[model samples]
Target: MKRLRRVDRTQFQKLTYPHLEFLYNMALKYCGNTYDAEDVLQETMYRAYRNFHQLRDEAKCKPWLFAILRTTFLREQRSLKKRPLLDDGSGYLKHVVDQDRKSLGALLEEKMDKANVQQLLEMMPEKHKSPLILYYMEDMTYREIADLLDIPIGTVMSRLARAKKQMKKNLLKKLGMHKKKRNFSIISVFLPGGGL
Candidate 1:
């Protein structure tokens, strides 16, 4: 077996250490607990260090690390019979509902909390949920998500569009504000003294 040299080890650490926090948080999102998350992260680092020479681009380090974490988490999940579902504490909720992202309608600034958003993510199908978690929670771009998930760019776009729609519809229903009519307006989300 080819052993990693000292310089290679240092280079690997330099490239991969900066993303430790991101990897851990994402691991938590996937595993839903500290123990499994730690296991997956440790394995990811182990695999990355062993295969550091295979990484072609330093600029793609984040996506590469993300992909490793995902695969490692999946392997860990398979070994365990049962696991709790994930919850994210990311600030994506603030950006999604209340921010200038006019593609999705505006809602009560305080209505959409992390729990509500995380619940919505939990309810989504994994294929769709993965993109949203990567994009909103991790602040990764569509391209990065596509690369990490090994899907086409168009697929990433479509999945995110559908995920957002699902989130909106579910939130509206949960908030007791679902309307059967077409052309849902941004102002429809705003309610006085009531939050999502």
Candidate 2:
């Protein structure tokens, strides 16, 4: 590993450390578990440290960190492709409670549950989920999201639109509220009260 000089380390810390919480939350959403989120965060930090010299603009640090986090998550997912799903023993009860929570009509509280929201994200396709998470969780602009994901701005908008649609569908289905196909503006699932 390349060692960071004192000056470089300080500058890197100044630019990056403040965003650790943001990174951690994003990682948690991406990994869907604390353990894997921690692993992803560690890997992201190590990679950032090693490649700190490559950063061209300090103002772009947040988006740069996001890029690293997103790539690291995609890599982790690829590596775990063959891993079998282990039953966590939280059987139908968990689903029942989740449904109840949704039906309670407190949109903010129901959406604020991290685990529940993360579970919903995990059910989404990665393409849609990426933009959905970036836009909703990070408050990133479509341009920024496009750059981070290496896709066009239009693509980001479309993915977000589709992501929102798919999330509403999935959420309604989970809450046993899906009756017919209609355009419902249920964006609260992605945005709790204001942000994640």
Candidate 3:
């Protein structure tokens, strides 16, 4: 690996290091384990360090690093010849809880707590889950997701839409059954203007 220049090291440590947690979380979501995610993160940093000189725009560092990380993880998965890891239910549930805790309070978290959502999401093919995770978890725009995934923006939007619909259907089925047993009414409110 080429040694990072003082300025490059400073910039990476200052700007990129802060995002390590975000990267790790995304990696964990992708790989479905802390160990694999850490491996991917470490490999990503190593690749980033080696190829830092090739990065043309400093402002694109975040997305660029993520792309590299995704590529590396995919390559690693292929090498291992293991089935693509799915959400283990617990990990994704913890992630959802953590996200809810961060953005919404515990009360809202309780209301939003649907363990089946994670399992349903995991059941989705990577084509759907990847874009959904990138768009929702990484807060990436469709265009950004396209760039990272090396696909067109329309594809990302379409896959996201389908993924969301599938998730909703699965959640509804699971919750409906649960409510039926408990003798509770399940009401679904669709916004007048929302499509998909």
Top candidate by TM-score: 2
Estimate the TM-score of every prediction: 0.41, 0.44, 0.42
lDDT of predicted model 3: 0.67
Residue 12 displacement in candidate 3 (angstroms) = 2.0
Sorted by lDDT, highest first, which candidate order results? 2, 1, 3
Residue by residue across 1-196, what tens digits does model 1's lDDT show?
2464877977988999999999998987676446667889999999998888889999999999999889888787675535434445763322222232222211322336656666766788999888866775566787898899999999998998777777767766775768755445532343211222
Better of 1 and 3 by lDDT: 1
Model 1: what TM-score? Answer: 0.41
Tens-digit lDDT track of model 3 for 24-61: 98897687446678999999999988888787887887
Q: Candidate 2, which ten residues in sequence have the lowest lDDT sum?
A: 92-101
For model 1, the local distance difference test gives 0.70
How would you encode candidate 2's per-residue C-alpha lDDT over 1-196 as one tens digit per residue? Answer: 2454878889989999999999999997776446778999999999999999999999999999999999998998886665555555874222222321232223434345766777778899999988887776666778999999999999998998787677777777776668955544454433433221
Best by lDDT: 2
